[model samples]
Target: MGGGLPSDARTMVVYFDGNYVDANDAKVSVFDHGLLYGDGIFEGIRIYGGNVFRLDEHLARLELSARALMLAIPQSRAELAAAVCETCRRNNLQDGYIRLVVTRGVGDLGLAPWSCANPTTFIIASKISLYPQEFYDNGLSIVTVPTRRIAPDALPPTIKSLNYLNNILAKIEAKQAGALEAIMLNAQGHIAECTADNVFIVHQGEIITPASSSGALKGITRGTIFDVARDIGVPIREADLTRYDVWCSDECFLTGTGAEVIPVVKLDGRVIGSGKPGPITARVLAGFRQRVLVEGTRI
Candidate 1:
């Protein structure tokens, strides 16, 4: 739901299938199974100040996710990495988000991924933001959704598959509940994550998050926050969390490539610390944003 680079920007470069093309010229077949059955895997990457943040980590996760689903990405890891950078350079992108997708190519209307002869690759680099500028400044209010994240045994949270019906259900629930975001629980009644971002909470003086084993995507932004935690000497742990823990938390936040680190000041009508973004969360968010702009392998 975000727009691409400005018109005056250089020709947007996109790597599709096996060739580089103008972003506007990139297209895929309607018969593609990924469009019909959501058979694909994708990663959302961020670039800042002319540098791509966490390029290696995002690529690694992309490969891991693809492997989990037994989908073959036609290009090697190094090739895909260069493709992403080239796409960014083609767009003259100094700061933006990248969506890298590998889909099951056009095939007969079938449910199986194996029916496809060749995997279709599409890369689109653009700018994105989940919330408006005011939300980050004023903090967010969220609601608990009836839709639970799929248990790991059923869909395995490790695979960032394209099937996102579970997430979409939670988003619908959040809209019905009159909140900006939805808090999804796992089948076991433990806090999992939001519709699109990983969750974290501050208790007493330590940072705690629902473990990846508890059915959350191992988010790149989540990993970066962990590094910041360690660098700042804040104790962090992966544990099982419940609605009660979130209700009593001193601070709460959500992380993703698009959402970044956004503080939640209220949950299900309960106010978080001072009903505002907590000191620790603010510091970590600022630190993480700063890192994105100042460092990374330049394109």
Candidate 2:
């Protein structure tokens, strides 16, 4: 589905399949494998102060995910990058989130993707979000969900594909428990990540995050935060982290394109660092924002 114009000046446009469509008119088939079976990959990108932050890194991850699924992108990397910028320009989006997805196109009800010859590519430039400002300022409380991350050997965590039922289920559990976010444990009962964002902790003046091998996404935001921590003289490390470690952390937070850097003051009924945003977390957030505004590349 596609359209050329928007109902209102603020509605803007989106690129769907091979055509430019009004934001409201962009739609995929009911039988598209991406929707039916989560047979696709996607990326979440952020725009800050009119500039797309770490666009190349997001695209690189997108391509890697596509390749991992053997799903060919309809455009080259350079072409796709330009198209993302063009979509943003057409929409007049400056400070918003971009969701780019590639689906296995329409196919039969069967699970086989071979019948779907062409993959569908769509880019929507729109504002997106996560935790409210109050949550960031006052800090959020999270609970450890019973759900465990998918074993890496089974689904390969590097594939940022659309199979998020696991994450959604955990989110539902968190909501039912009256918590802000859910902390997922690995198969072995160690902390993996939140439903979406990567998890990190600060202890003894050092920042530590769980290794991707522990079933977390190789997060671009996490990588940038690491660099920012180093620049600010906050030593960072990546290693296996357990629920006990999180319980005893001096400070805790989660990182993602949408989540940004949010402080978690409590986990599973335990208070983290006097139950407030710690000094190290605040400083790291400041560094991240500074880098995004000054050093980030424009798209």
Candidate 3:
């Protein structure tokens, strides 16, 4: 693996611009609008036991994000899906993460979208682990950062664009404060979401999270948690959340494609209920794991 060749191929292959290529050769241009202007859309999908989990949903979201940004995808849905599966096959991944990106392609040095000729696309399949086992076993530590989410009117969170300086600033705050994750608020001081994940809290036996309107991205894992909660007979809903609510809630957790599901035991400085993963959180995680293996596009 010295020169980007893995002992096994499960993490060293890529699909770039309609061709399968070695990771070392798959490179984007310096002038690509995606790199220069953060003009792009992406999706992080997961594969479980050789099956691509919820590929259709991820593709749908990608399409929606592209439409919102007025970006043209170079490939059709079927073609993109095929490329994803092929990338996984080339990498020989049994279980891994897939990152699909569509960029505005190379453009002039100036800020003109029309200067770009075509869109750039790439698919990468690789291994991912966002947190250590101990964190998942015990719980994660997070803090509320000063950086608020980007206002919906300015740039909707639903677009899933590459412009993530807002969240990155919040992450920097969390890291500086010795926290594993950061919770961001909207302009109204209402909870939006974590820097890299969606937030969920259990209060009085009812599970709740911030509505997407509050500036949180509707994550695939977050939606699956709703399904998981329902299968386990737990009530769930979307509502406004606050720092006080997180501190007082019976339990809390974060969800993402990379993070899967992780329990939260503390926020800011207050210890959450019992300071450990709760019964409901455990059940929902288990249920979500079960669904990952059974529901997917078989690769």
Candidate 4:
């Protein structure tokens, strides 16, 4: 199939398997279980100021995800880190997004995973497009979708697996509802997270987010926000949250590798506190931006 690229687009160099190849030349077998059965894991990392933000944390998550699937990465953690930096160097990226993926290698059509021998690994580094500047200033309006997050007993959210149809379905609902994102609840009807980000709210004077037990991914950005909150003298905690809590909270925001930290002014058509980015949210976001420039391994 054609890559459907614009003729003027730059040709990207992608790390395929163990070698770097042109984007158009990078290919994986159709029989790969990761393609057919979503038997794999991935991580989305950020490069800020020529440094990879939270590189070690992201890699550790990737390794944990792979172990959960009984998949062995082809390279050690140090080697993988080098590969990521080399890809950024080749792309001449001072700031960008990095996608590291590991798939169960080629296998027969059978559901048996043991049939696959080697795992496939690849990395892609490219520019990131964040939410519109207006959204950052005014905040986002979101809705709660009917699609709920998968139960941890069935498929743990902490795995960061390639199978994201649950999130995609919720995203579709958000789009249909004229919103940029959707809020997903867990099996017990407690707030889990957004389609692809972690949810946070400010109540009274504390910053609150759903616990990992609520089926939310252990987001790297979410962890960073905890530190940011502490640095800014804001108390933070993790607990089970409900829609009512969000509606009544003083502030709301979502955090992720791509979205960074974005405020939510309205949910389900109800205006959030003051109908604007709250003072606490603004302080935390500013602190996060400053921390990004100085933390993480230098590329």
Candidate 5:
């Protein structure tokens, strides 16, 4: 999905290394530790009606990841916020996607972070569509790939690190299997999450998802669903869920910054519920839509 962003986006201004520059000219060194060793972190945020949805939460999550990697950001959070808003404003965009990347700066071919003294930061605000419109209209068909999620102890899922070979492999498996997304399971066979989103299932009229301990990323959109469910009086909980639970559940859905809230109709050829977007799924999405425009940091 290209997202069908207008041509104007190609010429959009961007923030790169403490300076605003044309997207075409914004560049990073080939020796950057981020490119060489995947030593960095990032955040994907969305702007709705000039409202940077959950900007604070996204930054907080970015901070957590940076802290985990011991990567010191060049600018303060406030400065970063201003830069993000300015990038959007300069592009004359009312709604778009934002990518904030902080790398460990340029360093030789070595495995030491201390070798890189300066970190690189860049921001790009643009458009994105994770799936086709028809998919949203009908629903998505996903699969459970053989590729299991990395053990939490081995690599904390909480850190939004630059390395994504694990997720990329799972995505390849899903595409090969004719699926739009892949559901990853932990080493213990517990449902962890989708390749890029957090998953949830409705069981006996209650919403449930895998616990944080199951290697699920603490997604911002995933958290917003809790508020949406609560506002609509839909009970929700987190537990150690398995494939059997998802198959038997009444409904299923996934949440993420790019995916937002999307319904899941079929899993590995098995129809979920009635093979349609469930009522609760629709309501939750509607609730999410209501919050996006009104609750956020105005650009």
Candidate 6:
């Protein structure tokens, strides 16, 4: 456990292991398998209007990630959900972000996970830093990075694991390219997703995004957009996309827990759509905001 920190130095409450502790006191062992070998799972959740949006869906995804990694979470789904809500309440968080992490506890310096006896779990709830207002207003410009997404056979993108070096590398490329984000392709050079968000394009009033088989994460926000599109009678589908498709699309955007819905005005220096957020993008974004405010588990 973390020690020797000023009691009032922390402004947020963190659920460290099984105890509610100060933010400064939230620490995990250096020998944790999650740190040593990236043997862990995590989820990024959002709070809107004092409600934890899609809590059940996020917990379900976390469970799936644990199952995929063969990692056993110490807490049950119901218990974990309660912990998330409790953490938000303890921090007096009305609208913010929550990062829930479960790591294979402290173990010897080895890759084998069985050596770890207990699992380390924690929850952090704090204010979220959204994309700049200008980015939302003028839109984001992105480049296609050289870092291809990991093949599903090697590491399925569905699992939100702690091993994110793949994404970090692409993010670096984005920064170096003077863009806000980078779009990653699959092993076969098919459009996959962005460094952190799921990618989507609208062509001729139809919405299309890369299929899960194309190495895209099953993003909760992406799913929400699908639902919103259905409710609004906008056609949507999943398919293997390419740079050409993006270049020719009428509009482009990204979705994620953090990014939410942001339009892509440029890709690889080519302007997307009319070089701005499209009508459909605006409608879906509005619907998403409306849905989050009313359709979630109240904190």
Identify the runs in model 2 with alpha carbons over 4 angstroms from their true place.
1-10
Instruction: Please give me the total number of clashing residue pairs in predicted model 3.
Output: 0
Better of 5 and 6 by lDDT: 5
The C-alpha RMSD in Å for every predicted model, in order, reads: 2.7, 2.8, 2.3, 1.2, 2.6, 2.4
Q: Once superposed on the true structure, which residue ranges of model 6 sit more than 4 Å away at CA? A: 1-9
Better of 3 and 6 by lDDT: 3
Model 1: residues >4 Å from true position, as ranges?
1-11
Looking at model 6, the pairs that clash are none
Model 1: per-residue lDDT, tens digit, 1-299? 86765674346678887788876678778889888988889999999888989888888998998888888889998898898898888787888899999988889886877789999998988788689988798789999999889998899887887899999988988988888798899989999999999999999989999998899899989999998898777899999999999999999999999999999999999998888889989888878977887656688
Candidate 4 lDDT at 107 equals 94
Off by over 4 Å in 5: 1-9
Best by TM-score: 4
lDDT of 6 by residue, 149-174 (tens): 99999999998999999999999999
lDDT of 3 by residue, 199-255 (tens): 999999999999889999989999999999889999999999999999999999999
- Per-model TM against the reference: 0.94, 0.95, 0.96, 0.98, 0.97, 0.96
Clashes of each: 0, 0, 0, 0, 0, 0
Evaluate model 1: give its lDDT: 0.88
> All models: lDDT?
0.88, 0.88, 0.93, 0.93, 0.92, 0.92
lDDT of 6: 0.92
Colliding residue pairs in candidate 2? none
Name the lDDT value of residue 126 in candidate 6.
82
